[model samples]
Target: MSNVINIWCIVRENRSVFSVTIGTNNNIFDLKVSIKDRRSNYFAKFDADDLTLWRVNIASSVLRNKDTAIEPYLNDKLEEPADTIGDTFHNVEGSNVRVVVEVPVTTASVENLANLFSQMNVSGSSASENASASPFTFFTELVKIAPNHVQKLYQDIIFEKITNPEYFLRNDKIQLGNFAPNGTASVYLRDNPTPTDTEDNVQNLFNDLMLSLPNFGKKLIVKDTHNNPYLDRLKPDLSVFLEEDVRDGTCIPMFVQTLLEVKKKKSESGLADEDKGQLIDYMNVLIQHQQLREHFALFLSDGFRFYVMVYERNNRQYKEFITNFITGLRLFYILLRYDSSYTKMADPRSIRFYKSPGTYTNIYLKEFLGLGTSSRVYKVDYNNTQAALKYTQSGNAHHEAQILRFLNENNVANIPNYITHDGHSIIISPVCKRIRNQFRAHHALQLLRLLSRIHSKRVFHRDVRPSNILLDINNDSVVLVDWGAAIRDPPNEQVLYEGTISFASPDILNNNLESHRPTATDDLHSFVRTMYILHNPSKMPIIPDGNLATKARVIREYWDDSVDVKLAGPLWEEMVNAAKNGDYGILEKCCSIFKS
Candidate 1:
């Protein structure tokens, strides 16, 4: 019969230590979780990784090697006979023997140990007598032998401090005085009797201590009626920290993380080959067409992930158009990913090619006509009002039609409305004449005001050039059209990629391959260019000649004396002189000449 020895396990870290005893037959793994359970907090701060266990020798006082193994006799149900043990048993030759087993505490290790303990059935009592022999029973008995309240408190406090300092601070009045009956600490808030400065002093000390700790700091709060600290809920004034760092820790970051995780999981799930092929086909279509770029770019969310692109359309080489096409696709995909229900198809038929028109069944079409890449424009009638309609053969007409329908549903004013469609994706609005004369600055300002209104609702008119802006003869108003690239600014960032080359901002041109962010500044730049075009009908602005180094540099040097200064020489001289002298005020003043 093998001798049965009672082994006491003590796990220590920092300022705390926990101990449990079990029959010698039980593996070291069994003790790890027992110590963790004894140390973990019930309400907060519970990581399995923090638990650690090791052995110490009672005599000669040295730690044992972690790999050392101890065997227990199966037949020996009781503790080893003290009188029968020899000198060799007490001291192994050339070996440093210890009482405890050293094992790194990890979730995996704890689980393995728990499994081993279950198999060994290392109960405090043997099965022979009137007692039950189970691993848990033994564990409970061992915990009672050397209870560790200090260790438990240390673990709880540290975990709470790291994982959720806010919660820890809020519950500061609560005193975790002692271990409860269940081997966990009981915490309760104390009511002040004398109302002394003790609490304040304690808080000050804690604050001072935390100041030296990394990623820990004190937050100011208002005092309540009982002189207790009340958390300040008011938003702080804009400061360096507020401007540079993230404020809300929950929603925006969580959403982005969730989106990335979802994509990763989907990829790992092994989507059907056919589905993958279809997505690839859609991406190919995005790569092939310029118009498709505008259509798809609107769908992307503020962040540049969740993208799409068309590679081929009608077997055409879409290389030249692919830049904008991929950008459009990325925008659209992001939008769909963020809020699929709002942006995705409510009816499958909406995606199919259909055309119809009638007064009673007229659909509000203003929202649907996104900016089209193609040059061709059409005319349609709705609600007895004629509207200019642009048609592009390269992109999704159904999506554009849906946008028009959405605009109507939301009752967005001044936008061309969409009518019914059965065979073709057609839109109807108040008919407008194209500005035969070159775009002027005043016209650009009027357009900017309209765009400002749209952007106030967080809508970005990605494509805003002279061609996209229409002049209504009946209303004598400049009606903005084409939302094909329109996008809603996300919570934290602005929309990207929605403009034409003639009025495209430097940022847009420099970041041409991907969807560069669209800003109010970009729109301002476009407006300025439009004004320049109207003033100088005989000549256009040219990008400065230089070996392009950086995007910012290219933009700064754009329109550097590449054109003949004589054709509209005065305006050219003013612009060149202002640019050469780095006088933005003069340049802006000159730009004002084209207004209206």
Candidate 2:
């Protein structure tokens, strides 16, 4: 499970005394392993496990209290062995089993030992036994001195001596002794079928991509790092910041402008709530601490579900810009290879949108949804009637694309019908406003029923205000618009509140940010507030200024008076009781308020 190994070694530089005791599988050796001086000579290679196996044969004999010199059997002697064994002791007293073996060492051997020991901090300068030091220090040191032929063997010796041999193995390679089918000591590359392998491979993939940024004509400094400031409160999986470089001929400086929070999942389960929250937290942090005015991107993936969001600093809102049900790796490739920019739809012209029966011509974005913004609400002629189309230059068309398809499949009520998307834009059937200014009690019930249907699917329209509520006078139909703030039931706490301050529930306005757990009750509260604003439009009061204290005072005063309104009778009574008790059954309680 853990990878680290320790070997006990002692070297007497001046006295030419070399002794090492390597333990593996309770096999300890007190034998002299000879070293010969050679500038160019080949030696056998052995990994730590192999060296341990080789030493097992000589372990029992050398375990005697007497000194034993293990002679070096070389194919051809390049030089003479330095010195024979002078003294050795096998003092197996306590757990601190002290053993010494005199190894024959030449001048070259002494040089290597000195170089290795100096690096290991175990040079013969100290008088006491070199205790508590790891054998890995020696192996790593020998890697510099040992030639290619014998480097692995020396490393193996170090591994055989250490406690966690696996930890000492190279990260690119994995020890397969435990996993070996034949019970033989074996090692393989790290591309195995394991969660750690998948996670590691994903990181390695990004690291490789980071190294290849120069190919993309981008001259920004890029790095793949972990555990950095993301909103200064949370640490995300990957944090990449891109900044423009300002060079003064002498000094080069970088101004960070773009921060991305990247999450990876092993499977295609889609982005989890926590992962979404991480990205939201990162965006919020940048806005709060850095006074972020420029747009930055946030990315999330579960290897299965992929999403990209752009934080619009002007409005302090995050808009879903892109998403895909495809593999995250493929989505990452698309992000890197494909450039992200808004398609100019402002220059309107006649175009045909391909639908089921035939192509719908005369499709054009008729009105600007937000002046100076890259979004528009278009009126299109289709199916011998008119439909409304909302198009955006930069937003997730694919997310709504999938949702509308699902709604059409199930024949859900009180929502727009899915038309088509042209990679960057989306079209849907629009719900026109009623001719009359006021919505009757039955209209309220229809809207409530729509809210219930949406909630049943675990979705919440976080922004439930008047402008977003649309009406069709012919059928007395209700259509909720502006799903940019829509989210699943378990809301990501990192996402800052994007709803209207005046209509926000008391708990939502003063809820604990640390535990950003948003339930259906928050939406229900906003729904109740919407009804009051709609019915008593004249009596409503605007909280002066955007100050937090003033907004809090306004929300408190409004809810206390409106929820106890006696003129509305049992309908208002049911709504008041629901709000007072924090109950989420608002639609059920007010069912008596509606009748055919």
Candidate 3:
């Protein structure tokens, strides 16, 4: 029965929204009263009952940000008097705001119109006289402002605790002495300054200001991040941290007090997502990495203009503050006093390249050694140590890492040595080579033995293709790789198709409906199919015409053809026929298949 749980109500004709809290049983009219109460200044002449309300129903994905006009998107009207607040808005996919009430202009009364027009040029005396009594005149005046000024009026609202509630902003004139009372500051002017000049010049100007403002409150240390990279080569222009928090070069997210990004002009907001989006990237470092702190101040500036925004560690709630350059520095001073006295994170044994839910390879830009439909394998050289790094932009990295760690813990043989993993990359030692037609009968036997050991642990390497079978001839290693598709003792259910179709088990790939559960038998069956095909690719299993009934015929003919030439022992024939004909005896004898 919850209603408007921390949802914002976007009033009409305003650039922003104010948060609304309503009772579960509250109807559409109650929502209107709530909006009018908060915006009483704008709704002075209009009674709460007179205000019209609507229900904004839009997908969360399209909730535009930062003063986006909401008129066109507002199509749903709250005409139902019986519709409770909860029933009005669906919390579908974490909606951002309830853009409900829009302000309606109250037509000025005859006396109020006289008062307003009198001020229009009639006289200052008549304006001062009627202004106090004429609320309609005030509403009329607000209506005359441009849309951008309305944006300014709404941008002033922010979440409590992020800023002082008494803090107010307007397009009021600012005095130069507010920033530099002594004389014209160097930051105000530059020698032939261009768009690029703003970034460095502002950094230098801040450094100069810090030098003269020592102990004005507390000592603050600022580091220029122009050259220092963070979170894998991504860095903000400036970061403030204690000297001790500065490790080898990494900026611990929990310790960074404040961040600033400088842009030359605000119009750069049009050139890509440079303006606000750049601030978000810096915040992402903290929000995605750490869990300790609740909030931090990220300041954005365009030389003379300043902006403030607060995003929690989870980034669910957002608030922005706008001010002139000197006032923005005041906000920076507020950041300096932030209770960064939180506990630090302890060091861990294994390094975390990135956290789970992070499945992109944006951190790496090196050339890859191998590519596949869903993954890329890179040859990385880190501190004289070489390893093959596998990148899959999905949970597959975690899945494969889990299986490799399990098998590695059991001292399983022939699998690549497990190195640490983070992000979408899993590093394994001894880069192995792929085979086209080089697979041997003895190699097939060795792989069967490998799968035997894997199956003994009740783990199924469902994908037994040649590409996943790695060979390091000089090192005498026959390894198995790419365990992402492996299912670990899954229940007997319809097995959806996984792994390369060419090398996958016919039990999985051949069925018209492909309805079968995962089992150790499937791996053994897949291994037999792969071995027959790997020895001679010209003769391979084919689902001719994709007919379910004819699939067994083609498989039988393919396996019989391989067996006719004595490709290997009776194992390939028995294994394929056993799977093709639903023979389960071969599943029990897989350990000794090649041994026979």
Alpha carbon lDDT of each predicted model: 0.34, 0.41, 0.53
Error of 3 at 35 (Å): 45
Candidate achieving higher lDDT, 2 or 3 = 3
- What's the lDDT for candidate 1? 0.34
RMSD in Å for all candidates: 34.7, 33.0, 26.5
How far is 498's C-alpha from truth in model 3 (Å)?
A: 20
Per lDDT, the best of the predicted structures is: 3
lDDT-best of 1 and 2:
2
**Total clashing pairs for each candidate:** 62, 14, 3
lDDT of 3: 0.53
The order of the candidates by lDDT, greatest first, is 3, 2, 1
Ranking by TM-score: 3, 2, 1
For model 2, residues 60-123, the per-residue Cα lDDT tens digits are 3333423322221111111222221221223232222132223222112222332332221211
Model 1: per-residue Cα lDDT over 323-347, one tens digit each: 2222332332233333322122221
lDDT of 1 at 337: 31
TM-score, candidate 3, is: 0.35
Q: Give me the runs in candidate 2 sitting further than 4 Å from their true place.
A: 1-362, 366-374, 382-385, 422-424, 434-438, 489-495, 512-515, 539-574, 579-596
